[model samples]
Target: MRTRRLIIGVIIALIVIIGAGFAFGALHKTKTNAKTVTLGIMPGGKQEDAIWKVVKANAKKSYGIDLQFVNFTDGDQPNKALASHDIDLNAFQHYAYLKSWNQSNHGDLVAIGDTIITPIHLYSTQYKSVDALPDGATIAIPNDLTNESRALHVLKNAGLITLNSSQGLQATVKDVKSNPKHLVIKEVDASQGPRTLPSVAAAVINYNFAQSAKIPASDSIFVEPFNADSHQWVNIIVANKKDRNKQIYKDIVSAYNSENVKATIEKEYPDGGEKAAWDLKF
Candidate 1:
């Protein structure tokens, strides 16, 4: 009876050990199986919503992984979050802005894929067209360096002002050599440009902001010329330089640039959709 009891004890111990091993194996599997990636977006608007919807759905279906989107209200926030390792990836900034951030901040951010080019437009409530603006009309523009230069370029393009020889792409209000309209250009945050339109004689706004405010691109008094130079304004998918070769990184770009996604963009964006979308060469 003692021997029998000893054998039973041995069996019970083995069972316990085996069960613990299985539980550990299960935990390991769970850790490996939880495949998820997060994407940081600009904000919650129809344009952003449409892009996320197609990209997220395709990412899940094609890669058998989950894609999460976190929304930020302004352009500068995502880069800070990325540098802090708060997110896996972000897709809200144009290449020009991204380059400037990387140069200034010593960030390791890498652009894996180029996304859409959100054209900038000069919208006005007090004027029918850029030509109709009276002399000394006030114009509100984004205060950031990159956008401020672009805004000045738009005004120059409209024959309202000209930049000095020393004034380059980084030019500001001080660079305006000749203001034909005597336009008092006011620099404000890009996100607030939409709301300031009714107050300012005219406001130059990024496409996404205008879309969020329900302002159609066609209604803008002046829109940026769509040319090769404008391609720099295209948004890009960004991740840490270390994650550039990860499978999920490649999958995200694939999902976003797929034929289905292209079709959706074509159908939605006023631009010809995928083929004509002002994105980088795949």
Candidate 2:
């Protein structure tokens, strides 16, 4: 009977050990098989959307990632969704817009990869060039805070206006100390910038919006120069601050900055409407 009791005890110990090992293996497999990543995007451009379709297919084939997208029409929804963890990532905003969103929402989102610069341009139907506009002519610009300053800076750079130094990146039309042409600065929604053209003497338009409206590159009198002042305009892939260093996130960045993606950008925008910014130091 004593020998039988000792044998029973040994069997019970073995069973418990085996069960523990199997449980750990299951957990490891669960983590290894985790693949689905949902991303949020602002749906505006047909070409841009097609480009993302390519990324989705490549990510699945190359890394076994189940990349999914959540499209948002409103400009403000993506970051809010990301902050709530409703989506794992986003690639719609430039650094300046991201900074503005963070400040307004008190959120801690972070940029994981540099993508491209979809530059702002001053477009006109009536005026041939910057110098061609008559004095006191109406000009349109984006009304949003950061872009208002950016659009104004574009005009300043083109020698149409002089903004006071005090306003920094938050300048408005009121901050224009010198409008040499006495140009009436019209404030409109960023998306509406292109539509105001030919009505106003000119409008400063974002590249994606301009593309959607079928505005030709020849219509632009001034393209934002690729320099230190436009550093914040470089677009980026963003994630929640806590997920900044995740391996999967880094993998996405690598795929986006690949030669294949670079080739696609060059093919799509041969007119130089957008510039690949991953290799750029700034």
**lDDT of each model, Cα atoms only?**
0.80, 0.87
For candidate 2, lDDT tens digit of each residue in 41-135? 88747667767777787777777788888999988999999999999999899998999889888999999999889778999999789999999
Worst 10-residue stretch by lDDT in candidate 2?
Answer: 44-53
Q: Each prediction's TM-score against the native? A: 0.71, 0.81
Candidate 1 residue-wise lDDT, 1-282, digit = tens: 999999999999999999999999999998988789988887755755886798889988888779998889877888889878898899887778888999989988988887766567899877788888888889999998888888888787777889886755667899899886788899999999989998888999877678668875555888777654466667788999998899888899888877777766767775532233434442
- On lDDT, the leading prediction is 2
Who wins the TM-score comparison?
Answer: 2
Cα-based lDDT at residue 116, candidate 1:
69
Q: For residue 263, give model 1's deviation from the true position in Å.
A: 3.3
Q: Model 2 TM-score? A: 0.81
